[model samples]
Target: MASTRIGRHVKAPRATVYRLLLDADAVARWQVPTGMTSQVHEFDPREGGAFRISLTYDEPTDTGKTTAQTDTFHGRFVRLVPDAQVVEVVEFETDDPAVTGEMTITIDLADADGGTRISAVHDGLPDGVSLEDNELGWRISLGKLAALAETGELP
Candidate 1:
């Protein structure tokens, strides 16, 4: 029932930003938070397509929702609008009831003065996830996105 929204400006064209949003490799690079690595198990860049991804903590001591060090999730692309928006519904693979739920992530892109403006909304966060942590993760991920879009590199 909880949600978080973030807005960012990237010095890249909307089309470029949108392309990265749907690209598996790009997602693996930019969608992960700091101190984590991402692996794309399966990905289909179309509406109703399914994708599976895992985020693993670099530190061995860190716990994850699904396993000892990894958080795995599977989801479907709910909607896709070229150069505009993308919507996905995802559920974490976990035994813990507190972190079990389907979450919706919507990302919108628009033209900006020098580049593109991105608005991301994440809804239906499970109780196990804290708002501050979620927001911080998003901020880091978005910063990576911007860096990738602008310089073709993750920063």
Candidate 2:
């Protein structure tokens, strides 16, 4: 029942920021937490779309619930409003008792002075995932998002 929200301002237009957020390759590039690499097996960003992603910790010992060194998850895109917001209903591919249940995540964008203000809200965090870790993880992910958006790179 716990939730967390994080926000940042990116030096890019809302459309640019939104596009990067939904692109499969871009997600793989910027959504991973620091020290991890991510791969998007499947992704569809529109409403009712489905996506699957895997995150691997560089260090073997830092394994995750789905498999050694990896954390895999899948979700459905609950809502998508162009240049405005995206919502997803996600769940981890894990058997860990503490990390049960689905999480609702919403990412929103609004006009800033000269760019876009991005805000992400993550709801229903599993007990196994610590709050501090989630906070730091989001910060790192959003930082990458900002950099990628500013560069306007297609990956």
Model 1 poorest 10 in a row by lDDT: 125-134
Lowest lDDT sum, 10 consecutive residues, model 2, at 146-155
Model 1, global lDDT: 0.97
Q: Which lDDT tens digits does candidate 2 get at residues 1-155?
A: 78989999999999999999899988998999988999999998889999999999999879687998888999999999999999999999999978878999999999998999999999999999888888899999999999999985523
Model 2 clash pairs are none
RMSD of 1: 0.6
lDDT scores in order: 0.97, 0.91
The parts of candidate 1 lying over 4 Å away from their true place are none
True lDDT of residue 87, candidate 2: 95
Task: List model 1 lDDT by residue over 1-155, tens digit each.
Answer: 69999999999999999999999999999999999999999999899999999999999999999999999999999999999999999999999999999999999999999899999999999999899999999999999999999999987
Identify the candidate with maximal TM-score. Answer: 1
